[model samples]
Target: METVTISPKYQVVIPKSVRRQLRLVPGQKVQVIAFGDRIEFIPLKPARELRGMLRGLDTTFEREREDRA
Candidate 1:
């Protein structure tokens, strides 16, 4: 795991390797979350980019009769 130090301005610069791996671009927004003792950053992708992301997935699953609405 890579480690980063928070700057005096309360900002941390993401490493180039990490940024490239995540396909993070400048001006892209990320959602910050504080979970337990660690912070998490999730990239916010545009809705258009999500199109066909789940293509050809096995979505056929049986549901119980009572579970049907």
Candidate 2:
């Protein structure tokens, strides 16, 4: 895991390796989520770009016949 130091201005620079791996570009928006004791940065993708992202995935699920109504 790459470690980063938080600057005195409360900003942290993402490591070059991590940034390149994630294809992160300057000025790109990211959502910061605080879960438990860790933080997660989720890239904000355009809705159109998310189209067909789950193509051919297993969507089958068991359900009672009555539930179909």
Model number with the top TM-score: 1
lDDT per residue as tens, model 2, 1-69: 999998999899999999999899999999999999999999898899899999999989999999987
Per-model TM against the reference: 0.79, 0.77
Q: Report the lDDT tens digits of candidate 1 across residue range 1-69.
A: 788999999999998999999999999999999999999999999999999999999999999999988
Model 1 residue pairs with clashes: none
User: What's the distance in Å from true for residue 19, model 2?
Assistant: 0.8
For the record, the alpha-carbon RMSD of candidate 1 to the native fold, in angstroms, is: 1.7
The CA lDDT at 32 in model 1 is 100
